[model samples]
Target chain A: MDEKSTINKDSENIERGNNIEVWEDVVNIKDLLLSILICASAAMGGYLIAPDDPQKPLLYGLVGVVIGFLVSSMIIKPKRTLRFEDEEK
Target chain B: MDLSLIMELIAISIFGAVLYTIIGIAPGTDETAVLMPVTLILVLSGLQPISVLAFFISSIVAKKLTDSIPVAIAGIPGGVLSAPMVEHAMVLKNRGLPDVSIRKMASGSVIGTLIAVPLSLFLANLLIPFGETISKYSNEIFFGGAVFLALMTKNRWLALLSIVPFALLIQGLRHLYWGTGAVPEDTTVFTSFFLGITVGPIILKLLELLNKEIRSNLPRRTTNDIVLKQQEKVKGFPNPFKILDKKETGSAAFSSVLGVFTFFMSPAGMTIFLGEVISSRIKDPIKKATRAISSMDGVTNAAYISGILIPLIAIGAPLSPTALGPGMALFNAPPVFTEDHNLHHILSMGDFIVATVIGAVIAISLTYFVTVKYSQQICTFVFKYIPHEALLGVFLALVIMLAYMDAGLINIGGVILIGLVAGVLHRWGVNYGIQFMVLYAAPWIVGNLVF
Candidate 1:
């Protein structure tokens, strides 16, 4: 009975650990996809709107993608900050 | 105004006030989401300009007053602007003083609007001489305003950098629309972009369902019950002035005046700023919280009224963030009213004043009476009977349909894309004010530099 209980506990711990790892991986992927989507959509927007010239659309689209990349990189991720007493209640 | 115009204004005001009051009670229902489409439809249907203005002003006033109902009772904010009121409201709710809080907010709203309209009218008149000159420098002003708003955010540097990219995106889309040889309507492009930005957070959250782990972790409400204390029935014709004390009334009036003058500032930001400024002076915690809530309510109404009125009356441009955002249709509706010839050109000052005053009086009187008398009943019904998720789904559907109708099927895709991108920026602490400024200034930025 004791041996069986110990084995069950070990399995539960492994499952929980796997779940956490999977959650983290999903979050990372979501973040990456968000960035990529923003960049690609911006490029597409430029291409669609670019002046009637065929080559100009492509050039504008590339420029848009570059700007999107720069802006996304500049985004400041939110952080948890400890507050002191002086802050507004 | 003629008798026919006067009658029309009254009819429109009543309709708008009733419709918007109901919409305002439902938490998460945005003023813009409802106002934009409705105003567009009304204008397109050949409603008189004075009547449209009357409808627009009354709807806003009624909505702002009734929005406090959800916040004070259920602790769920009615909209983004009401979010700041929730903390103070929850405090009162936990103490079994929600009725008191509700009365305070409702009263504050009434007094605030009463103070704001005349003051804004006076200010608008004062600024009219410089209207043409101001409009001429709008491009430069927009650029400067964008930078100023960007720097006011938590992620200042990031927001500053974002302006260029956002501007580029808007210009690109505009170009694409024009390139298609479509009848050249700027409103269609802007509407989609605005809708995209407004609904971005919800889109991102929905998209997160792709991951089962994330979905499992999402918070779920177990029950929909909201408890409230019973109050004595008040006699006929409730007076808002009697409910609030001298200090609350004074503070609210002062804040409303401040809000009227600071027309360019974002309403939500102004609410917080005024609330904190008013509350901090009080030493007692309870008094501070209550006063803050009341003053915040005052600021909300005052800011909205002034923000819309000043710009519309003065420059005939959607200059303020509030005007540019929820009130965009008023300034620019195509095939009938365009940016070049808007409501300012169509309606006289006398018409604006009469419509606004009559609309405000009727809307506020009705909303205040209903709120003060039936607070508990309304709260119970909304929380117990209404399915929150179903309401959200309906609103989302409406938004999608509106986006499709305004732009094209392709613009629906554009809306989602913009929503997601803007949603990411929002989650990272970049605010709506900066986004709006960037959107409004994009054309000027591209015209001078990019071209």
Candidate 2:
């Protein structure tokens, strides 16, 4: 059946013709620095908001979110490209 | 330990594995969501740390194989870990290798688990001191990780867009759970995480439902084609590792190194980056045979296992969704389990090592046998019996129920609204990951700025 489909079907592959590439880490490292600044600034800001106030839970959660964002950003880099550049025949 | 205690441990392992199997089969759900409720139960049950570790491993390995099934049968993905698998599965499906691909994954899982055992233990030993030293600067390290992710994305707006939404969603859901504490006293962290994962997709699906342009533009569901082109050349014993080359070997090695960085990063993201980089470098002609393709899955499993084990042994960081599931076994083991200095942590380590080896063996061994015997049957069955739209519909409903189960009906409704907003954002070529990052990141930023 696969043979039949391949023969009968258009040679066009769904995944074909697109070239996705990964960015170099040098590029990624920069993004990591920026993300950290944003998150830490955010977290430190949260810590400042309720120095000793109620809603410790919310405050702590805010801190965690900042950390999570910073960490997630650092850990996960963007895809280079979804598909590779297609070569024209 | 008493006989009953041993029996309980066995039960936990079995239960964990079963739950993992379910997670593996289901696309939207992940190990974290699966393990959340289970973790609560373990904490309450007072299970021994070693036994809890065993159960966690069993479930994780089971999911490794099961998760590949959906990606192979349907383009719809399952676990966050399985995203790469989806790409490969699509390739296999076109080539009449869907069953073969699933088997490869299973084989990969087993191989990964086995290889990870000693590798993780060795890495854990190194990470222990490193973790202790880095504890003070964990904040800086994690922050650096975030920035690295943003810049790596290439498009700054796309990166921020993806990162922000996820951060906010996590924070918002966390707040919603906390808010409910005054009312029902039932809201918990497990529910909050579950709500986040479940609601995101459900909201996305709802948007797919609501938007007229999208609804109209949705492609007509394609019928499954089960017949295959017979190829004798494709048959015979193929070395599973035969696909690796110099470039992919490099990525795999990098991924393995990054695996140890869980103290400040997500291994899943690292795997994607490594795979992407390798994919980017491979000039088209060499892409398929690129060692990175094979290594992507291998390194991911390696990284994932290492990520979990390092944290467990080092600073007791339950980082991976799987590790976090059995979190109590590491973080809060009772005095009886560890009367001495952090002996319970060692117990978690031992279990991780053991489970990794066992899971890897099981995944590889079973995948091979299953693929050999039933690949054709399974593919044919999927094509003949399963309706693509029905499968999608089921997934949609599952996502909603999963969210509802986490934070109550109100939270589910909120996620639906969130998903619609996300859908609109997605239309603008913004990324899903960056959005998720934002949702996860926002609360802290907001609090810090306000305070």
| Model 2 ranges off by over 4 Å | A1-89, B1-23, B39-43, B130-143, B161-202, B221-239, B242-254, B260-264, B284-293, B319-352, B355-364, B367-373, B421-443
Candidate 1 is scored at a TM of 0.76
* Candidate 2 local lDDT, residue B226: 41
Model 1, residue B123: C-alpha shift (Å): 0.3
CAPRI band of model 2? incorrect
lDDT of 1 by residue, B106-219 (tens): 889998899999999999999999988887876676678668766766688998888888888877777776777432654436766776776676678767766788867854
What are the per-residue Cα lDDT tens digits for candidate 2 across B1-451?
3677556665666676665664466444555545544554564466655665666566666666566676665645656566544565666555555555555555455455556657777877877777666555544444455557666665656655455455555556567767766225543334334334433544464444446676555443212234343323335644444434455445555554555444235445565566676556555533442334345555556655665666677656443433434233445434433323333345655555554455444444444344434545554554443333333333333434445444556755655656666565544544343343343335555455454
Candidate 1 colliding pairs: A49-B175, A49-B176
Clashes of each: 2, 55
Best by TM-score: 1
Which candidate leads in lDDT?
1
Isolated chain A TM-score, each model: 0.52, 0.39
